[model samples]
Target: MVAYRSKVVERIELPARERRERALEEAGYNVFELPSEDVYIDLLTDSGTGAMSDAQWAALMRGDESYAGSRSFDELESAVAEVMGFSRVVPTHQGRGAENVLYGALLSDGDVVPNNTHFDTTRAHVANQGADPVDCPVAGARDPTADGEFKGNFSLERAREVVDDVGAERVPLVIQTITNNSAAGQPVSVENTRQVREFADRIDATFVIDACRFAENAAFVRRREDEFADYAIDEIAREQLRHADAVVMSGKKDGLANAGGFVATDDADLFERCKQRAILYEGFPTYGGMSGRDVAAMAVGLREAVEEGYVTDRLEEIQAFADLLEDAGVPVYTPPGGHAVYLDAGAALPHLDAADFPGQALVCELYREGGVRGVELGSFAFPDTDRPELVRLAVPRRTYHGEHFEHVADTAAAVLEKRESVSGLEVVSEPANPELRHFTAALAPLSD
Candidate 1:
């Protein structure tokens, strides 16, 4: 095992209880709306929240800035081709930008897209294009206590039903989100990916991998899938991508970068259409929506993200964090997941119903109790849907340490102790766009 240390540190002081209370009230009870200064530990997301490595920083310094054909773009393209095994690459500002560009090119009104489970933004982007996003995660995913190694696997049966209902023509894209975020960040198995690929081919739909956390997913495959037990993480990752016709990735997550994303594909027709969409929605095909330096840093981060030692350590750390929560009597998703430890908010606060926003209530309590901010992935995020009430503590890559998670565990335990006291929230104000309302929605305590 390789030892790692923080060569740099930034001091952060926990906000006072009263200040947190005021901040929460001022932000209308939305954790995402709170200022960073009030948050001691921010687990709102892992996207663009990681610390850059020395190599990434060096790459940034040497980045070439040009309007049309920058060397930085070439480097990023080469890295994506090598790591993801795609012949073409298109950079974007972030994961959602990649989603927007790709979906814009493929989706049509009344079309259907299926995945293991679509994350918040993915679902929103699909809806924005007047397309429906269907989730087909295995049944085990809904049961937080189910100790399955690959709960993230897409259900081929469920997908078949969708295809039959919509007709294969209306189903344009079939995606698998590796390390499925919406399903407690669980990892997809290689067998499942191959089967999904076959299913897609049968339906004449394109197979796409929502590969934001592909490296972490590959690590899980190496451990759980018997066939790939001896495979290195990168080798397993390549195999996973090999099953896909195209890939959309958030370089921020597994790439270990602050910001950047890409769409890669072997299909020339789809690649050309995606590039045109990128030119309109993002930027020129070369730079897309990223700065030259960000593109360069992403190139280095992508390679670093798959190093055997680094990927293994990342999984071990997340598992250790989950162990801490379980030891504290906190209800967490079993077997842990690649990036986050999801709290079963419904189990913790059984008194609160789905309409009461149990997950958001838990998020509020955590921030007020310990200045720790976590995001809700339940009714609040997917309103009117039968999703699990989960509060996700997404640890940023190479950011917080064990002490931080220890504090989170203790805080969560405290919240569970006073679970009955926690009140559900009613939306006071929200954006007109219901798909992305959770980000800016205002809420007040539910009336007794």
Candidate 2:
């Protein structure tokens, strides 16, 4: 129902996204491949967040190892302790699975779950528990990296005020780290983490972290903060872990393995319950439904992910791409800082009416010309049918380097030039539900 203007720089005079659509269809293997195999720079997701080291891969695939039965739990446990320093450690199949168990256990139907902001899965978990998640946009925090750190952060003061009003016991406070993907991977500094954690303690509230991106977050902290700048990645990670009572992680991101997730906590009672639930959904507590290979990879990847110049390089790559877009006169999100450039289609396509899919048009154009795939922010990523559309270009961490960026920049210019020829989103099928989308890639001609 409402929309904003997009600041897309003009480039090509007749955007021909339809051609690219044909190309993609011709390829026909793009089935939203599993996160591990997909190279979607994932600025939009912490999926494929971490990758395993050679050593971890070696350990995971050792033929001498029992794929079905291994003392992997010991390895997993030790790794969790070393990384999270939690009093208790439990495993799960993946991040969202852990969230389901965590929120399912903690929240009753009537209870309220509070967080600076909720990741998609975490939010869904709480909602499924028949509880509503209350947003506490902590500490005047408006993307400290508005600028783009790719480490997750939220406002601390907002956290405090929300806890105060909710009376801690009624609403729990959650602090997550690394690639606060929702806010463009902004880093939540150690000091801020401490502040928010302390505030939760002040009110006798529970604090949980959605710590899938811990590795990336730690790397950023080490690079930026004076105190942490000196600490090694491992030490910085430990520091962040000490602040949260519990954290749910998608091992995919931090562990860099193919699949695995865990819940780490100091609360004995709570930890036990979660572990039991995990077994029901996942596997034994020891493996948490993971193979020894994955556990090994996660162990190694966790280490490498924080290694000097690892995460920073990926972030810088994203920044460079954004810089080119900016130089090209395309209005990218202010101060490209993370792993991808988020196109403010609201600002880019102000003329797009509700019936128009401005973001889709941009995405289609980008894809058609450049063989690039970006997410449709409005209806796809954060689908609010009534809200304006936006497009998110996630530069997959390792898929492309400078060359890809240059192509993207030139392609963006081309799209801008043919902005009027850009088409609107055409829906093919609404089917039975709001979540279901079945549409052929069709666009409306941009209105003159």
Candidate 3:
């Protein structure tokens, strides 16, 4: 396959084996704390890690640095409206900032927000608002072995169960995360989105979309859903988002920018409330928590993210990464996903239990073996939540090539060969907020 875009000016050199070991020890076995200089392949996250396109870089110069009524804000608002079908836009620093700003306006104490699967930050933001975040991903998502195409789909039955238990009046929001990050970056179907929309309407709750990877999810919908087989990627994206009343998006993901996010809605009342919150927590509504240049770049990225060529290349790259891992006898979550390849840490390290943190152990082993940094999506991330133990190798858009992923596969295979020798991790120190502990938790080998 030909390169869609190519320019590699910066170069990186991996730290020595001893340096990598020392770095791991210094970080207390937490990959998140490891300095980038010591890591070879940094898969810690896709957020703010993607390479910006030339067009986006050029858009930076068009930024209006005004404190209010900036031209850059107009560009972003227009992009959000044209691509996501939202009428109002509230800028934020990042995705969690958007979640915080929007949820503060929408959720009250004891309110329930049902989602396909809430990622770490989303869950934390909801909890911080004194509301409950209930995950209702399809059954297929729970089983790492399942090969379903739309495993990220919100389970209407499960969500209904939550509503039935909590009463519809207590359910204020129904959020659907595109390419559900917590569920192995699986894609949610348009049919599922429609079903969720109907459910939200029946319950008189606002339907929201956590649209970090909206374009990726739409690409999957176009490939898997018969009804959308003929639709363009952008059309599919708009169709999926159309079912939602509002959206909280992290521009870092699908937007292909390093920073920036937005909360968009069609409801005037809700939009006004979110804007108020943004003004209080973030900066002025025009710039929010970002600079004008960042907003402008994000505007360009939002449009580029929906292009069919870019979406196809990204999906293919992730698929190839998953394939490479599987061929190397690494246990992986099936059907692949949009942004990352999830390793079934429990399956790979069957000797360890959930309490032992197999996912964290796999993360540590991968880094120690090859200076590769990935994150645990299991007990460490969710803490007491009964979910699959998986390690996520999130690929940054336009950052790496086939060779990098090939090296990752080889590293994972090496870890698997020594799987039994890999000791489980025990948390030595964690944050007060259990939901956000994974971000800064310190761990140690169980054997120690």
Candidate 4:
């Protein structure tokens, strides 16, 4: 079928190449690309739940009584203990920092770190360390339900298969978490988490919780299962801790605090081993590289994040965004789970295939028409270089007001209208094994 551009266009040739990109920008149009915008409506990820109160921020800035051997460490430790109910906790700069220590210390070059799907950074750390980061394709990994709700649920059988395929001695940690980021915020139910617990016990594999999206998981628990629905946030958090040896938190998202994270566990021996990593990457074990105030803030933030209204508010906004797109006839990730919406760019623009940079093209178009930004997921976030990419839009916790929904909806619909005429994408070569792969956005030029 012949493609067509939006009817509301007036094309003008520009002498300078920069002018061409500038023209799109000057129009105040955009779909936020990663690393570019503050108000990016992102569903692509989350630490867990994010953005602590100003009080928490102030506390973090106050600096705990301990810098290295400070009381801050004790305060922070106590806070970590309160959340996970584990006395043994080590602080890291952030989530990946925690991963570095975990993999650097525990995993040898030949070891395997298995999970449902490791985040981009986690995968990089494992691969860079010369260990195979195995994402045991959950049973339903290949075929996700339309809504993508079940994507986070890993098959115990798949875990078994991977373990059997690669002996347990070679597998260091079985770690994965809530709102499996790569899977459209699909949640792994408590039952599945428990199953993992039993499996870990059977295999003697160390189970690590990437509680990055723990709050969302908790929300799901309350929504999906009745028994959990009534449980208080802190109570539910404590119970979830039963299944894992330790947790790596990204305070940015989960703790609701600013820059700090923790590697925590109740296992005394493993806890001591984890401390060494602190000395190397983080500061002294006492402070674990974070100020006591951050500890205090996170401690307080963690509790506040669990407030019923807060989680509910975030969920409502996400649904509202989803509703906006759905009403516009957009092919959104059905049954949108958490913050942000996944517009099936391939389906939305059948004229442009996902293989030809559908996500990147769509994102560029949105930016050219509306000043909203989002990331690519199926088209970019997904694994398998030769697979569909996702243009992931991550909506931060409480990032938008009601008016913003209209901006997102109208902008998306306008782009979808020009779907047929939008240019397809081609990878102009990316660096091999680079940490951040850069892609230049281009539309197949209007040819003769």
Candidate 5:
């Protein structure tokens, strides 16, 4: 395939290490609190940070700004229908909005929701509703270095056990996140989804999908699943969604849009309920929480994201970065997932124990050493859980080129060279609200 060429039109100057360290200290050692100008390569997340294509920008100008039933909504609805095989599309400002409305409508006190692995926000939303969120990832998923092809697969046996233990009545729904973000962005097999759907049906529970990276997941399915090798990406995506009762999507990731999300379903009753909640919390059913321009960009991005050439190119870019890190002897999660490369902070900084938050430590060191910002996906992000300490470098869609990744790889290598000197961190101040504490938690380097 021929490569598509694009030119850069904007540039920003980054601050020096001393300036960045002062900013980091003022921000209380939270990478999230640092200003963009202070950082060099920002990889905090792929969410809402991708660069829009020329066509997407053009579509934004053609946005139809109507209070209800806007033309842009029509296009978005049509795109969602065609790409996801869903009949309804209730737009939102971002993925969590979709989750908020969907879970709010379905969950009640004592309800239990199971997933392969719940991303931080998803887990928080479920917990907020007085519902228990359980993770039933496949056994291989726990091992970061495992070469399992479908590490994101849900454990069917565990799912059945949960359903039996909690009783079907107490179980509101079973969610499966495509390209499981919390589990190193691993892809779930098409066969796995079918099996989970059957299990959900047997237990009389709803099976919804957290399809933030559906396109990228589809690309993996086409390459990894023998039966799907002959199928187009859109067809593979539709087949995957066919097993789900509904889909909650963050258009920010796969939709290639800067900001937009939606809850899609073919079930008329669920659609109606979600639509009502969307209106109450988000906006009118058509526009939800997004503007007309965002909707238009998302509609175009939804289509562009699933193209065979584009998916291949994007995956290659991500893998190249991961390969670079691995070559430098960094302990990276292998069989690289669709979106991000996860560095094993525990192994990278063996001197720091889990209690010291090695992941958070690595995140700080990367910024202090190279002005590169990344998010910690380990204990700092989930204090109650025993999840491994990891620093995630999520690649934004079409945002950076090969040169940028090379720079990141070099920065990471530089940090590793002085890994022994990198100290651990302890909480200086934590939010009163325990939920999602990593976003606002303050920390300080431990004394030698």
Candidate 6:
């Protein structure tokens, strides 16, 4: 494959390794608490951190700043229809904004929403609306090293059980998160999505897709699914969307934009309801919570993200980085998910218990040793859950080249070399609110 060349016009000088360690320790061993200037390779998330293309920058300058009936909105709507096959689009500031609008409009007290696996914000929104979020992921998904091609798939039997237990009337929505984030960024197969749509039809529940990484998921489908082997990535994406009643997107992820999101559907009634809620919480339907410039940039990004060359290259880079860690004897999720590589902190640091926050320990150590920052997706993120303790290194799209990934791998290797010296962390200052505590929670090194 031909190399795609882009110029790097900026650089940051990282502080010495010891100074970085001291900074982390002073910040209560929290990577999030550290300043960006002190870090080198920041992998906290792929959301809204990708490098925009020259075309996207050009689109930003063409933005229509009209409060309503903006030309930017029209471009965004047309782009959604062209790429995602959704006729009606409601823009928002980001993915969580899109979730807030959709769930707030659809969910009521005593309602139940079933998904393969809900990400943190998705689950939080459901709970905030007085609704319960349940997971129906396939059994294999629990294992970090599971080789199942569609490990992110929703279990049909489990979905049936949920519907039966709660009664179909009580279940308003069934969601399938394409390239499931919580399940180690695994992709849900096209066949499984069709099955979920069928299940939704039988239960009289609306089928929705959490499509933050839909392009990546569609690329995986083209590669892995036999029926879709000959299909183009965009075609597979459209086919996947055709199986859903609605889609909630975070444009920050797959859209390649800095920040924007939307809730889209063919159902006119659902569109109206979501639009009303969007105006209430977000901005007007035309602009949602985003500015006209953001809308224009997002429109360009939506088209750029699904290009075959770009998606293929992105996944390959992610897999190569994961392979590096795995080769160095680090425990990683096999066959890596679409956007990021997840390290099994529980397995890697078995000496420390979950209560000690082994994942958080590894995260902090990476920052200290190599100025590489990553986020903990384990006990720290979901305290009461029985999920595996994972540390995610989310690679930003088209931001860094091969060398940067290699540097990250080397950093992980350096941390692994002194694994025994790494100590777990204990929470020192937690927020009064239980919702999304990981973002603001403070911790300190546990006494040996």
lDDT of 5 at 38: 88
Query: Which parts of model 1 are misplaced by more than 4 Å?
Result: none
Residue 415 C-alpha lDDT in model 5: 90
Which candidate do you rate higher for lDDT, 1 or 2? 1
lDDT of 5 by residue, 273-306 (tens): 9999999999999899899999999999999999
Candidate ordering by lDDT (highest first) = 1, 3, 5, 6, 4, 2
Candidate 2 Cα RMSD after full superposition onto the native fold (Å): 7.8
Predicted candidate 1 versus true structure: per-residue lDDT over 256-330, tens digit per residue: 889889999988999999999899989998888888999999999999888988888888988999999999999
User: Which residue pairs come into collision in candidate 3?
Assistant: none
User: Could you give candidate 4's per-residue lDDT for residues 356-447 as a string of tens digits?
Assistant: 66776776666555655566655444436433355556676644456667777887898888777787665544546643343323234223
Clashing pairs in 5: none
Model 2 TM-score on a 0 to 1 scale: 0.80
Model 6 deviation from native, Cα RMSD in Å: 1.2
Cα lDDT of model 3 by residue, 1-448, tens digit: 5346676556777778889889999999999899888889999999999889888888898889999999999999999989888889999999889998998888988988999998898899899989999999888898999879899999999998998898999998999999899999999999888999999999999999999999999999989999999998889988889899999999999988999999998889999999999999998999999999999999999999998888888999999899999999999999889999999999999999999999999999899999899999999899778899999999988999888899899999999998878898798998899999988989998875
Give the distance in Å from residue 91's predicted Cα in candidate 4 to where it truly belongs: 1.3
> Could you give the C-alpha RMSD of every candidate to the true structure, in order shown?
1.0, 7.8, 1.0, 7.5, 1.2, 1.2
* TM-score on alpha carbons, each prediction: 0.98, 0.80, 0.98, 0.84, 0.98, 0.98
Residue 420 local lDDT, model 2: 68
lDDT of 5 at 254: 96
The digit string of per-residue lDDT tens for model 2 on 1-448 reads 1111223322223224564455444433221321322222223343653334457667777522353445666676777787667757777778878887787778776667666556456666776777666555543233322443423456765665665675667665465545565554456778878877877777776778788777667777877788877788778888987888889888877676678888889899998889788878887776777766676666666666666666667667667778898888776665443445777665565666646667766775666666556666455433453323555676544444465578778877887877766656555434332222312232334345
The lDDT, on a scale of 0 to 1, for candidate 5 is 0.90
Which parts of model 4 are misplaced by more than 4 Å? 1-20, 23-51, 137-150, 289-293, 382-388, 434-448
Clash number by candidate, in order: 0, 44, 0, 39, 0, 1
- Candidate-wise lDDT, in order: 0.92, 0.62, 0.91, 0.66, 0.90, 0.90
